[model samples]
Target: MTSPLFGQMMDVPLLASSLLSHAARHFGDTEIVSRRIEGDIHRYTWRDCEKRAKQLSQALIGLGVQPGERIGTLAWNGYRHLECYFGVTGMGAVCHTINPRLFPDQVAFIVNHADDEYVAFDMTFATLVDIIAPQCPNVKGWIALGDETCISTHLADMATPALSYETLIGRCDGDYPWPVLDERSASFLCYTSGTTGNPKGALYTHRSTVLHAFAASLPDAMGCSARDAILPVVPMFHVNAWGIPHAAPLVGAKLVLPGNCLDGKALYELMEAEGVTFSAGVPTVWLGLLNYMKQAGVRFNTLKRTVIGGSACPPAMLRSFEDEYGVEVIHAWGMTEMSPLGTLAKLTWRQQQLTPDEQRHLREKQGHVMFGVDMKVVGDDGQELPWDGTSFGDLHVRGPWVIDRYFRKDDSPLIDGWFPTGDVATIDADGFMHITDRSKDVIKSGGEWISSIDLENVMMSHPQVAEAACIACSHPKWTERPLVVVVLRPGATVTREELLAFYDGKVAKWWKPDDVVFADELPHTATGKLQKLRLRELYREHVLPTVDEKVV
Candidate 1:
């Protein structure tokens, strides 16, 4: 037997710190603008950010932080949070980003589950930190991401004396060098939204993070470039802001971080003022911005494209951006376990030549797979489905960046080496994937499957409907029926009968919702995805009118 042959090549491992170093060396003058929680704008360059990140690492070392330990962050998308992203991971510590929007008990549960040694949070989370501090006994200390005045006034009464972010880093001269660890060393830890149960952690390594950054910055993915000003409306705590914190620096794109001011007006103003050419966020945030623009009769000056994910992007929202505002809406889909980037709806050159309407329909799909991810649809027997654009099945994916098993869990979540995405979807011959519905949210009525997403999209197209959520409700004849809960536009009037009638020609007769209920708002998860689990619980016993009539 012949021994395996190997080629001579450089063996340098890919690490997250190298990304910042590259940006600082080549794109040192590029700006990273952020809207501060202090009602002011903060500006810095990539070189400055690199220096401060090193200082932060040194400060953490001075405070006795060790490699392989978990350092938690409970802050929004801002400079300090950005520093923590690189510094903590660069020094071989796991950067655990906890979503502050979660319930207090959930937050405490995450901190305890991860065994975070120290928590660094923004001043805005002072009250929340104070409430959860007693519950998280393992946390050695708390660090406020603010100046001395912020700590003295906001966090003075904490159970433990809180350290100030500015003061802590000021003492260090940034002399510490980043450690060169194995490429598989853990770099980031993110927990799911826990809409079903307690949030589970997905641990990411240096190699995976670096590879994810490379794929995320591709021309077909987020399309990041140094010539563009990129704004990530997604919170930093959510899957590393969909990997933009890493991708932006990789491509030297000017970063504009909107810190907790997610309302339409503020976002529009920030984008305009900062010359943001590209942005990414959840559909809910874009809806607010679109509503504001429609009401104010305004238009964007510089924003050219936006990546909409965290939930299904309604067709109406996509039309509003492309047809009305001239902004391209790239519908995306992913989960925390996949490092949050699986596919982006970038049309191929062949598809782009199709008629405008044809192209629009193609763009509505979740999209083609990125280079690093390999996906397929499987049936109940775990057999692969055809790519005929009609056969829908469970979506499974495997990739270097994708999680093999969740943190601290003994069992692997993968079946046959592929992670089930919990999404029911179809793929066309061109390799474009369209998500029909979540497996849990798909409505089955009298043995017929009805896509709640399809029903909601139709209802959302109506002029009066502000938002809609379609869920399964009990039926006497049919096992289940679709019930749509709708929130109307302000000052708009539409009766339940009228709204239900509007769906007449849009869908099949049986596919139409059986009942329409007006609601002030719909429940959303911490990551901005619809909370269908909560809705299912809330209306599990709800009876359709036809069923009620039979009962009467």
Candidate 2:
């Protein structure tokens, strides 16, 4: 038997606090700009953030917060919330970010489920905190993420008197040291949108978070660096702004937090003024920004690249940004379970050499996996499918950042150690993944599957269509057929027949929508995903128009 030899490398635990410490030491002067909820622009540096984070840790420790305790935050993206992110996690306590957009009942349920001791909320969410406070009995107290004036002005009428965030940190000196702990300890906790039942929590460890940050900053990923000014339009309450809050500090990029103001004009002006070189957000957000730019007849001065995730990016939106605005669009896909970053649609050298039209078509798919993630498509029989770009199946992924099980659940959600993504997709031989439809949303007609995403994307490409959703409606003969619900652009008009005919030659005749209905707007989840489940229920009993038997 051969003896195994160990390398003489030092043993060190990967910690989230070290990211902040490194930024503070190496890029102390790097700026962290924010549009505060207080209706003002706030600016600071990594050194200043580190000092305040230390003070916040001291204040949390003084409040009797112990290791592994959950410290909840119901705040927007800003300097104060960023401080809490590092401060709570750095002190060995779990930083639980509660999405304010969730229903009051869901918020309360998450608070109780996580057993959070203290919840620090922005003044913007003061009323929300007041509503949920009575339901979360285990929570010791609520801390307002504001100063004395803010609390007196905003939280004065609340049933529970909240402590001022500034006051708590003000009482402590900035001399606290972060404790060293096992890297596997939980550092952050985030709950799903809970569209069905009670929301479940995905607990993240220090090691996983740090590794995710490193991977996210890679050249082919978000490509964070000290020279870039990055704005995360995604809220801090959502997957820690898709890990920008950590990845930004890790690379010393000038962090720009867009506080409650997510409108097109606000985001566009902020990006122009800050000279943001890179940004990441969902497709719905970019839609607003593109509409604003087109209407305003303006152009970006320094904005270059954007990562569109949270949902699929429409081909039209990608073309508009890349062709018209000269901005590179990196279409990305991920879920909350995998630290929210799995694939990004950046063209490789070989793919880039193709014709521009071919490149555009290829860019529509979710790109190759990040270095840490391993994924495969499996058929109903649990057999792995080939990556031939035609064998659509359930997507399964396993990675260090991916969750093994829900936070307090006993049973595991993994199948053979791979977490099923609930998405129906095709992976090309080149390793690119294209999501055809969510498993629950796929339309089945006459024993054949129709991708609702494909129909919706094609409908959205129409000049007059503002937004579209495809749902499975019952058919008299085909069992279930595709029904499209469309929202038209303002002051634009298009007949249902014309829109339905527009799909000619674009997709298979059988895959074309059987009916089209106009809606003022489509439903979206709290995180901006299409609420197809709700749409399906609303259109479950919808009747399709009688058509020629041969045409059908």
Candidate 3:
């Protein structure tokens, strides 16, 4: 009898510091571009990023920030904020990214809940810091991401101890090495955009953050690499900007950050200036870009692929990108609970062999899950459903990067060891997932369910329609009927009956929205998801004419 010995390897921790160090050593010359809020472009290198990040780490340590303490950042996507990401996490403190788009109350609530010891912000959020400072008693100090003049001019007379980020880093030579940290230690914190009640925090560990970055960098996911120039239109406060801040540096991708200016013209000019090859954002942002380009008869000089998530991407938007701009739209789906990367709509070779229309249909679905993640659907009885492409159910997933529980909460959100995604979806035999609607947003008419997302997508496909949302309207006979609220593009016009007629042979007759209402704009959440609850409240008493009246 013989015994076998296992192979041994070095036991190095996968800390966030490793990503920055790898970039600094391997791709130091790569340029990191940023469109600053002060109406100018900021440029630096990864080598400089590492040195400044280390200096910021020294600054934090000098400010009495202890390991495991929460350090909050209220800034846009820029070099300084990026430095904070590595500096705080590398020094073993939790980097809490606060969403400035959130209400002042929610901002204060999140900071107090995380018990942040220090806060770093951009000039754009100087007013916000002043407003929330009185509410957050635990925040002891504030660091504005700028020089002395900028800080004094932009962020003046703060209640707490205040200073400029440049001044803080200037005092140190940046030679302080990063501390050795446990892989399982908390590294970052991001609060969900409270759809139900108060927002809940998702505390991420170094192990989870690194693993998520690795998974997202794969070719099947975000396809990040060193040669690509990435523009993250998505906010850093939103699920770590869908984990791009980590994935980009892990591969040394050039970063083009749009700071506080996301309008189509601003984004297009920045992308043109930086030669952004890849970008990520919600559908609304892409819509703005598409409209701006279409109006100007301009083409993307180098932008190639875009990852659309936070909400579903309409098929019209996909076609516009591919047909007009030659940009491949990667339809993605995720939530705050999943470290915000679950599935990306990448077509398989076999599916790509199909006709263009057929392939477009497949691309409309949220593609398969990336490696390290698994998903299944559950029926109303809490039983798992089949992957027949027709059996729609509640989508549930579990993965290495997924959250098991909310920060500081006692209850576990997992059911049978899987996190319920609150999305009603169907996983086909080929493994493509089509999300029909949110569990709460589905329209129930005469005991049959209808997908509001499907209706909205159909409506947005109209050339004149800029945005659309379908919600269940109160009805007398049918109990509930789908009503479409739409926003027409400027200089375009369409009648309600004309719009209704446009849906004639597309979807099921019953699934068609019974009525249409046009507005100047549709309300959206901070993350750019359609604010259906607010729409429902706005039109709670809306009633559809009887079917007999329609027959007349």
Candidate 4:
């Protein structure tokens, strides 16, 4: 007989309401801070926010926004957006967050697709709303999340009445009991970027979200606590800032909100001013900060550790922070399915004895799977590969919080009970998983897989390159070719030939980019992954020399 799930017998439903409110009841005085417009900072306590969120929930209900209604927010990370994280969901409704970074059409499509009844937006996104509101017919209303003094210069055409977020909250009655919520009911709907296809929604259950917060708080995961002041530089719309909003108050940690300004000088200023001890964001955000620090001659005095995800953290980026700046970048890997946290790259006790250089090398891998996560690499014949770190195969994973299926999509991706993460990986003798390449992003040039990530990481190590992205283009002989697009650092100069020369001795010449394209900036997805498919389309016509290129 199979063993029962440990908490299966428990009757109490773990809801986000319970998580946010419980902390407010006990840890009421804890601070949640945000840097607002014109560099002004605003602050609110957990108790204050919980009380307001409850009031807002009541106000929303009074607006005939019934239970199970879909409410959306188009604001950056702030006290108001954090309030709605609880307010909408706590009222027995679904909180839908739209990534402002998505194309206007995409933003409109998701809002209409989700049938969001209402939208609350920031003033800074007035132009974004003007473009999106008319396209989303189901969205009956738009409320601007700003003070009365802020002008809606770009929002004249929409019929929806734009009310200030403050006005709505001010109308709320501060005392309201959050209804007892069903654990399986949809609390939030997060859409996966349509890089592979159309963005689909993931309906997070009350139980899954609360439990995931607990799992994320563990030492091996984010290791978050009350002692830390956290700045979730990650967008709040993305998996609820990768679950930081819920996790931060779990221990009543002081929360710092960055409010959409992710530039290095701004983030460094916020971290220093807020005394932020920990933060999490995509690798690009940190990479910008690293470059900005080099030019500005600034330092991150308060930040001790960071969680790098959304893309692989280049070894150079990791070493620059850990070795030079005294900050640790814990590489975490996951997709929208696993509540998106499948792995955290932390060195084991034995590995600590390795020299710093060796540690940086090991840290480049995705690290071992976390406690609740079970992973195995399978060959073409369906046999599990040994953990020798050399043999590569398709990576298959299974876990509770991981998505078995995308909401409202039919042609099933799940084979049996296991979900194929669409990643190619290798398991080593030490039990660490080194991701060889993304299954889709993997280049099959002459029947051999070339990792675009590995190639990009190597090129990023070049001092003149600010960022690099590798994409596969069409090839006549090999059937596919790798072309690298590089973003040169400002004031630094390098030619395509120089970059190819840099790779001559390091990797097989054939593995080098068939041709390097220079871009002032690389195209990025809404979630920050390089939009390689676009690059592939942009450069498919130019063919690289095959026979003359050094294959050895």
Best-matching candidate per lDDT: 1
Tens-place lDDT digits, model 4, residues 1-552: 999778657577778899888879888888888877535788889999999899889878877898888999888999889889999999899999889888888888888888898898877787788878778877767878766655344345545568767777788778898788888888888888877656888778888788788888889789999899999999998878988999998878999999878899889988999899999989888888888888888888889999999988888898899878999888988877877788888888999999988887888988877777788888878788888887888998887677767777776677667788888999888878888888888999889888888899899999898899988877767877788889998888788899988887777766877778888788888888888778777776766765355444
Q: State the weakest 10-residue window (summed lDDT) of model 1.
A: 543-552
Give the range where candidate 2 is weakest over 10 consecutive residues by summed lDDT. Answer: 543-552
Ranking by TM-score: 2, 1, 3, 4
What is the Cα-based lDDT of residue 403 in candidate 4? 73
Count: clashes, candidate 3: 0
What ordering of candidates by lDDT runs from best to worst?
Answer: 1, 2, 3, 4
Clashing pairs in 3: none
lDDT per residue for candidate 3 within 1-552, as digits (tens), equals 688987699889989999999999999999999888777899999999999999989998999989999999998888889999999999999999988888899899999999999999887777788899999877888888899887667656655457778999999999978888899999999999986689999999999999999999999899999989999999998889999989988999998899989999999999998889999999989889888998888999899999999999999999999998899999999989888899998988898899999988988999999998999999999999999988999999999889999999999999999999999999999999999999999998888899999999989999889999999987766778899999998888689999999889998888888899988888888889999999999998776765444421
Q: Rate the local accuracy (lDDT) of all candidates.
A: 0.92, 0.91, 0.90, 0.84
- Candidate 2 lDDT over 90-200, as tens digits, reads 999999999888889999999999999999999888789889998998999899988999778777778777888999999998898878989999999999988789998
Q: State each candidate's clash count.
A: 0, 0, 0, 6
Q: Which stretches of candidate 1 lie over 4 Å from their true place?
A: 156-160, 548-552
Candidate 4: stretches off by over 4 Å: 1-10, 37-39, 151-160, 381-383, 508-510, 547-550
lDDT of 1 by residue, 253-360 (tens): 899999989999999999999999999999899999999999999999999999999999999999999999999999999999999899999999999899999999
